[model samples]
Target: MSIDSTRFILLNTSHYGNIGATARAMKTMGFSDLVLVAPRFADALVHEDTVAMASGAADILVRARVVGSLAEALDGISYACATAMTPRDFGPATHAPRPLFAELARSEHRVAFVFGSERFGMANDDVYRCHACISIPTHPDYGSLNLAQAVQLLAYDWRQALGGFEVAPRVPDASLADGAQVQGLLGHWQQALTDIGFLDPAAPKKLMPRLNQLLNRAELSAEEVHILRGIARAIQRRG
Candidate 1:
């Protein structure tokens, strides 16, 4: 029930303001360690709309990490659930929130609840990554939740899991990669991409910038970054 150990990841957010709002939502609930997967606005959020939405939760927004794929985003999670408006093969739809939190309370595992973009929920392959799905009930006619609102709902459940306990001192997530290691992996990724001819060497103008946007947004921990770099190296070795 310690909130620090749990991860609430947002996948493919398009708006900087929503990202900021999500950050604010988490912070308001005494939760931090929010992760964004393939966020559309990497640069624009730094200006102001995001900060304004964060309000007092600006620090959480500042500390957010962005990553590329859902697989990579959920790299270290032991228990994963994808939130959806419709249910899939693994589980039925959740019209209520308490039972889900009740399940979360019983397990001492490291869990991550993944939310997809507003435009499209989650892909079938992405849903395959999770053990189940969480659905927030609303008026059956119009139950869709805004991105930030969805995050707020999950954050509230996480708070309940803690039994209203005071926010514990921030402990580093053992799963995330350190900054230096992530930097090295980024370098390796660029080099590998160029080696594979995915990037043009001479005309590599926007390539690094794009890579920076992708990698920097992840803010990957040392461990996660190395795991990813290892995959990249393996691919190169295999090729």
Candidate 2:
């Protein structure tokens, strides 16, 4: 089956440099129509360093759309897979790179591949959102991988899957979390932290910063943020 832009997605990447590199790689594979789902580097733009890495596909960087949530990022995607270095309890047993690639080769539906951040991999809920798991095989002694490395690897396989077939037309997906939804979640998170003694009003110095870092790092999707807010409200009620 031929590949289309709709069959792929990159999620929660934290660096502009990496995003640029990813755009280049996808373009190299003859895939564009990239959707950034609440990437940490939401302010990213086409810069010299990124363009340098993108090489021939620098234009893809300019055309990329940055959205606020994974669900929005993944809207209309028929199949979903999370790329993780480690398997989690909530997800299916992981697949090695080639096997996952082979399976993807067989499928005809739109697929999305999610890559988590540099530090913690995809969260439990995010993994649950995927239909399968793809893991890059690395040295057993040092299994960690950089974000761009992971994206390039998957994109490489997808390119192979295309295998001389012309790529299809682009179809846009919906955004899962709009601005208002994410803001509401942030507000609830802030309130919950304040109410739970996590943020002391008398010395509201370090906590807000740390909370901001955590919330920002999470790259919370609209649905995820709302769900988290609900959990926060539940916790507050119990307290």
Candidate 3:
């Protein structure tokens, strides 16, 4: 699927902030096309809530269009996917985003992801016409999702199928504590626990083994080992 050819269609959005937030979400995933199908407000495209939510992605909103109907919104799209729960009976097949997007990525289809309004989702009639329904798996107890959040998730998964950007570390990873450093910390901790009578050498009873397991699970850094050793020293002094 062409990222440029993909557009997000919000159907009858009631909340204006969601419109702006959706623009921001689309921009982050390298999607630019945003079409609103009959938003509640006439000036939704330029609404302050939309602009404020767009943040650095104001360009997306500037290029966004407002349409009267889904048919008009999907004018040039080859495949349209509705974002909603699967129809229990007989409608389009419902798929999770990743697998569906991966399948779509193999083709040159111009896809549009249609989202329903925040209050009431898309009509069954509207969903029946789509090629497939895309459902983001959520807890069975509560599946309610914020509109922009759903857009962000679908956009991210679709972008991943199209080869996402590599993550760059903001800071270098911390140096890990070597076995020798860990052994030293363990020895120091042993002394502290023994002095405090928390562990009796005569009747250790798996206490040291349990502490070892705890530290091993912690996956300590070298700096953390040194800090822990200092605490052990303090404990011994207090004892």
Candidate 4:
């Protein structure tokens, strides 16, 4: 299933923060089609708490659709999965998110994950309408989940099944010190240690070897080697 074709649907959501948090969750997972089925407040799409919780995903709230009913929200969607605790006597077969999502990944279905209100979960009718009811495994004593948290967990699992995004580091990786550079730095530090009276040449023992092991473990970068050499120069000047 294409991430672009997936939608997150919320029914009768009572808090603006939930709407905002949902937008943030969807954006992080590379899914953004959001639909609200008769939310408690008309301004929920742009409420202060919603915007605040959304962080930087306001574009999702702007494109989100508000509909009168679940039918309207699922107009172009081919599949719907209810994120409600399965009804004891009735409703569709309950499935765990990861396995169901893996199965869905092969199909071309335009899927939707439907969530219910915070106070009361989806009604029996809502669970019955969905193709599958997803009961996120939680502690037996408490399975209650925050509306945004459920959406996030479901979205994350689905995204992983569809193939996750590549992680990138914020800063460019520094060039590591070559063997020669590390040796040079070690020699400089050894001199500085002796000059500072921290290491005695007659009683050197394994001090330099132990320090060399520490630097090797640190994986010092070329720039770090230069900095250490500079400190060694300062110590020599002081002596």
lDDT of each: 0.77, 0.72, 0.90, 0.91
Best-fitting candidate, scored by TM-score: 4
Tens-digit per-residue lDDT, 27-141, candidate 1: 8787887788877776634758878888888788667777888888777788887888766666534436678777777887778888888788888788887876777777879
Steric collisions counted per model: 8, 2, 0, 0
Tell me model 2's lDDT, rounded to 2 decimals: 0.72
How big is the positional error of residue 5 in model 3, measured in Å on the Cα after superposition? 1.7
Poorest lDDT segment (10 consecutive residues) of candidate 1: 86-95
Per-residue lDDT of 162 in model 1: 63
Ranking by TM-score: 4, 3, 1, 2
Candidate 1, residue 222: the lDDT equals 65
lDDT of 2 by residue, 1-239 (tens): 44464445666666678777888777776777677776665466465666777777777877777777778877888778888766576666688767776676777767778887665677888788888888787888997777777777777877776564466759654346655776677677778777877767787777666766677676666667767888989978976
> Who wins the lDDT comparison?
4
TM-score of each model, in listed order? 0.64, 0.62, 0.71, 0.87
Candidate 3, residues 56-114, lDDT tens digits: the string is 88899889899898889989998999987646477889998999999999898999999
Better of 1 and 4 by lDDT: 4
For model 2, the run of ten residues with the poorest summed lDDT:
1-10
